[model samples]
Target: MNAIADEAIYSFGIDIGGTFTDVILHRGSDGQSISTKVLTTHLDPREGAIIGVRQLLEQWPIPPRQVGRVVHATTLFTNALIERKGVPTALVTTAGFADSLEIGTERKFDLYDINIEKPAPLVPRELRFEVEERLNARGEVVTALSQETLAAVVARLVEQRIESVAVVFLHSYLNPVHERLAAEYIRKHAPGVHVTTSYDVAPEIREYERTSTTTACAFVKPLAEGYLRGLQNNLRELNIGAPMFLMLSNGGLTHLEEVLKNPIQMLESGPAAGALSSAFFGKLDGYPDLLGFDMGGTTAKLCLVEQGAPMLAYAFEAGRTKRFMEGSGLPIKISTVELIEIGAGGGSIARANSLGLLNVGPDSAGSEPGPVCYGRGGDQPTVTDANLQLGYLNPDFFAGGSMQIDAPLAGHAIGRLADQLGLSLVKAASGIHILVSEAMASAARVHIAEHGRDPRHYSLLLTGGGGPVHGYCVGRKLGVKRLICPPSPGVASAWGLLVAPVKIDRVRTLQTTVQDGDLQAVEQSFLELEQEARGVVQESAVQHQKTFVKRLAEGRYKGQGFSLIVPVPDAALGNEQGRQALIEAFENEYRRKFSRAPSNLKIELVAIRLSVHTEDLIEEGLQFPSRSGALAAVKQVRKAWFEETGGYVDTTVYNRDLLGSGDTFNGPALVEDAGSTLVVGPNATCSVTAHGSIIIELH
Candidate 1:
């Protein structure tokens, strides 16, 4: 097939991770591209963003004025919460429940830990005040709100000079009237303070989860709002008039205004973008079932994609006391892609435990000190240092040689670890790599099993900085037959931002079994949610853009503790046959998830959900010009550690920018690119695809 560059419409995507800021420029003509990664400016991530953007434009010879809309994603909000650096906020809860945030259902993640610590409550107990109000599950007021008590609570909040407040009442999800009125009074009395209500934030049944979600929204609202506003102003200053949209953890884009009111929805935004990109690429390549593997500088994220869609979870725990524990941190009841993440990225620090066992990280050196190989004052060994010592990376050519790696230092770092472990340096380095791969594969297995799926059935699509470098070994460990690394694996998250759909998610709580037969109420709730979604998508629309809305429901069998999400078509919800059809779909989904549905029980619909989306398709005719002939191996052959071989073996190194489609290479080889490197281990072979990607098949 001839190269197709004509469809390249120039667009940009920016993703700011914990350790780096990645920028990508996609040229419409021939799919010519530019990608860059800059050290994150933790003081102000925007500084690194600007630098990355400029570097990409300069490298591609593209002027900033001609650029189209820039899709941006970031982990800033997530990091702020995890690091406990968010704004100080207060809480105003229903009477006798001022300690809701602190109590947290009294569930300990570690059942028997003598000294296990829970994440500290975001709002101090002193700042949390009790207000008199009560609502039953049926949305009936059991006790009238005491105005004097509310006023007194407001007086206390004012005295404390609280900057933000969260209003969570008993059973407010069933009836939001009390919450609405309290919010209004707070705004009127405590002028200049931010307020969020559980009904508006997360209209779910669980009081603890709903209250925590609302509190987090209030806690981060000021910081996220101010940061986004600053970013918007910076973009406007650069003459980038295109509508600014922030990527959501749900794999959609939301307006800046919406996010300012609900910043909790932005957690996992950066990693979610990478998962979306991998799913999008999988669809384009006709792979329906695949694994989206994204490894950046600080963490590796793995998500399962089935039928071209990523799995969604309604609740997620952040800043957990235990890594994989169910109830350790703040709970957010929001729609988000289900993914497993671990501290196994390139910069994961290598250390000796107190017991003298070698351990890789849950902590990282980050971009500042980086790895010992980076020669940036990092004396500690890291995953990058391991890769460098094993000869998987080219020291002088790392990051296109813009930054050189200190091989001698890497050797020294591994050497120390080896001495401690009673092993040779190469064995220690390779062991670290193998251990990391096993950790990733193990996590992926657990995540897949949780969803009632087998991990062995899916293909692994590896992306991000360390993913491709270590993908082969990881894939082998997981029994994956094929691994695909795209043209720019390191910047996959940036690519995902550009390809995401403009959308909004709206939901309404309607907790009732079919015996209540409130079908009309159900339909009405969906209609209201649809209207809210339409308003959001309409604002996101551009000229001539068509809009589409879809309906869904959170449902379960009566008496079931949990629910399964099922899509509801408008046609079905609009008519009797359609309603029955949706019921069948729900039953099938329940069976798929739980082996079987209880035929004796009625179906309970928990929430009416809807999403209005406007799809922006990338032009189809874009193609990059072909580089003629097979890529020549530029560097002399070297002995690199191959874990499978149990020793150092001869390996070949080639420049990726010069590689032509259809060229083939074997394992124990390195394909070096400007932005990242692809390592092919022993017993594997890679072929350059028509799209300039390296497809590796394991034996």
Candidate 2:
């Protein structure tokens, strides 16, 4: 394949993580890129973006107008939901059906626990108003919507003074006639208030998921829209004329208009960006299957990527009161990259429990006061503090030495917790390290197991500030043989946004028996939906120059509650032979997933989902230095603890900037750069790749 480059297009990517705000500026002409990381301003996330952009400008003198594209991904919306900071929302649904959000399937994910907890509904009972409306399973109106019912609902909404309203009627996915009427009336009467409908957010089969998705969109609409608009205005004020875009949870980049209509799509976009980076960079070296790991300040995420594509899931829980408990969180229906997240990171607090056992965390010190070593008024010991106490982190060179770590303060905090556990300082620090690593490994096991995957078959792709620090130990525990560390690991998420495609996802419910249904009509349905999706692409200014359309449908046994995606060929529905091929394809996929297909059950097609993507974004000819195994790269030798050795070892510290392609080094060693530090275990060997990445082969 030939390389493609937009010689005139210069792009900038911005990603705001809990601990850092990363910015990257790239010139398409030469494939040269420079990135910078600044401390995140949590009080106002926008301020962090501004500060990072300015810092990068100081280092690379590029005019703002010359930058053609600006893409951003952040954790702001997800944090808002977790912190219970959303706009006042009201739910308007079919009469007597307002409880679906609260009565989700009534199946406890944890059957034996008596004190199971679920997230409270976004809209309370007093704010949920019902109207007379009904639709059959066939999209036919059973009880026609009345003008009086709309009038009464609108009156109640105005009286409540709610900031946003979610309208979801019974069988709305099959037919949205009543929902449309209610929304139209609300917009006219309750002007200036945000309105979202179930069919617009999630047009699916399940009522509980559809209603919850609609409510979540409403809950965050006001907050996300206001923040985005204000940020755009600020960019304009700074004379940056580039078209700005936002990242979506599905690992695509879309304009602000689409995200404003459905804010729930951006909830997990931050982690999705990091996963995309591994998929994109891993392919450059011919690795197809990867265990993408990103450990930041407050959380660690692991995703499975096969052949440069991340696995996508349609449903997941958010804001779980219990960590890793499925049913305890709010169910959201949106296309998102499948990743498992745990509260194990650099900022995870370390303390002795009442039983005198040391626990790493489900809590974090965050970036406000930060870890004890940050010397930002944090009194509690965190993973970072423990790492510092163990000499894995350099007190004189933390954050490129811009912020000096308080080594003494960090010791005092860890020492205090060590006394409670009746252990020495070194043992206490090592216990914290092992405990957090085990937690990450356990989460990865569960995530890989759910997909019937073996962790031994995948190589760990590490990114984020804390990723390289913990990757070696975690991969060893999982019995993985290899780990790859990329350049600027902490800013990899921002880098992912630079190479992401502009995509839009669309869905239509078509519950029918494939054998009995008219195949031509099914083929015709995809074309119609493709047209609608094209309308959205047309509105985007950055993409649609060259586009691609993929078609897939969800299929299941007649009585099943779940479904699997089956690819439908372009010519599959036009003829009898092609139609049989379609059935065979579905059956093969079903058997592969479940190991068997029921002989007595018939097959049913549930829905058709379409994805429209812009032309694949390509970046090639990124120049790197030739191979060199020179001794000048080594900066110093410091005494660092190696748990495998049972004590401290003299570790060689290397300056990453001085390392070249094909360079090889033996551990234990520290590879330090401005953005992050890579720790090589004594049992592993590190080699620099042609792409300027370090590959560690663990024995």
TM-score of each: 0.94, 0.97
Our model 2 lands, by Cα RMSD against the true structure, at 2.4
**Which of the numbered candidates is closest to the native, going by highest TM-score?**
2
Model 2 per-residue lDDT tens digits across residues 1-699:
111234445777899988888888877767778888777889889998987777777777777777776789999999888887999999998888978888888988788889877788989988988888889888888888878877898888888788999999888898787888888889999998899999999999888888988898899999999999888887777678666788999988888888888889999999999999888778877787999999999999999999888889878888988777777888898889999999998999998888989999879988888999888899999999998877778888776776778999999999999899999999999899889999999999999999999999999999998998889889999999999998778788988898787778888888777766677777888888889877776565343267889888898889988898988876657578767877787899999998988777767889889888775464463445553453778989998888799999999999887888888889999988777788888999998888888999998
Q: Candidate 1 on 99-174: residue-level lDDT in tens?
A: 8777888877888998989888888888888888898889899988889989999998888888889999999888
The candidate that wins on lDDT is 2
TM-score of 1: 0.94
Number of clashing residue pairs, candidate 2: 0
Tell me how far the alpha carbon of residue 138 in candidate 2 is from the true structure, in angstroms, after superposition. 1.3
